[model samples]
Target: MSKSAVPVNLTDRLSQFSELWSQKKVAVLNDYEVKLAKLKGEFVWHTHEDTDELFLVISGRLTIQLRDADVVLEPGELFVVPRGVEHCPVAHEETAILLFEPEGTLNTGDAGGPMTKVAETLR
Candidate 1:
């Protein structure tokens, strides 16, 4: 669903989840999708060879652990991990994030594993 006809209140959607490392699709726009995820602890190291991944911290904090450095983000901050760059996302505590990526972009990227999900709509 597109938010063009209605406002998507992220805070409301986020309240419905408590699972860590799971992404829930909220809306779709053209070829991209807007998703929300609840995270805690550390995520697997992965990379999307075909598409850059966008991460927007909605609440709490997150750190994108790249091979060379760690990129930390606070609420309202956003970052795009370039395609093909190996990276891991770790959350010290419960964190909420919003992601904008191509429709079929894998959550685990090219490093698909058990954590990899067939991204689905939550509502």
Candidate 2:
């Protein structure tokens, strides 16, 4: 089997955009999508009832606030929020993160407010 020649540079792709809370698609694996997002402040409380959401911090810090406790992650760390669990992500400073989830997973999940965004492919 032959391997694909191109490699994705996370930093280079991240530099293409500057919008906070918006996800940019970098690649897809089977039915899932690999996305990069810049985050700051607090996101709306939401729950993905069908699939788990993975968050990998590429830079700065992040706090995944749950109903009972908060899970903090620094650079190079990751966390997965299980399905049906309510979660809110907070970042005091500008944070860069990679998200792995099923294709078409909404950024706002069930919240569906103004902050919701469609993950546009990074070209």
Shift of residue 61 alpha carbon in model 2, Å: 0.2
Candidate 2 residue pairs in clash (backbone atoms < 3 Å): none
Which ranges in model 2 have alpha carbons more than 4 Å from their true place? Answer: 1-3
Q: RMSD per prediction, one decimal?
A: 2.0, 1.7
Candidate 1's clash total is: 0
For candidate 1, give the lDDT of residue 109. 86
Q: Candidates' TM-scores?
A: 0.93, 0.96
CA lDDT of each candidate? 0.91, 0.97
Supply the global lDDT for candidate 2: 0.97
Instruction: Please report the candidate that would top lDDT against the real structure.
Output: 2
Q: Which ten residues in a row have the lowest lDDT in candidate 2?
A: 1-10
**Model 1 lDDT, full chain set:** 0.91
TM-score, structure 1 vs. true = 0.93
Task: Please report, as a residue range, the 10-residue window in candidate 1 with the lowest summed lDDT.
Answer: 1-10
What lDDT tens digits, residue by residue, belong to model 2 across residues 17-111? 99999999999999999999999999999999999999999999999999999999999999999999999999999999999999999999999
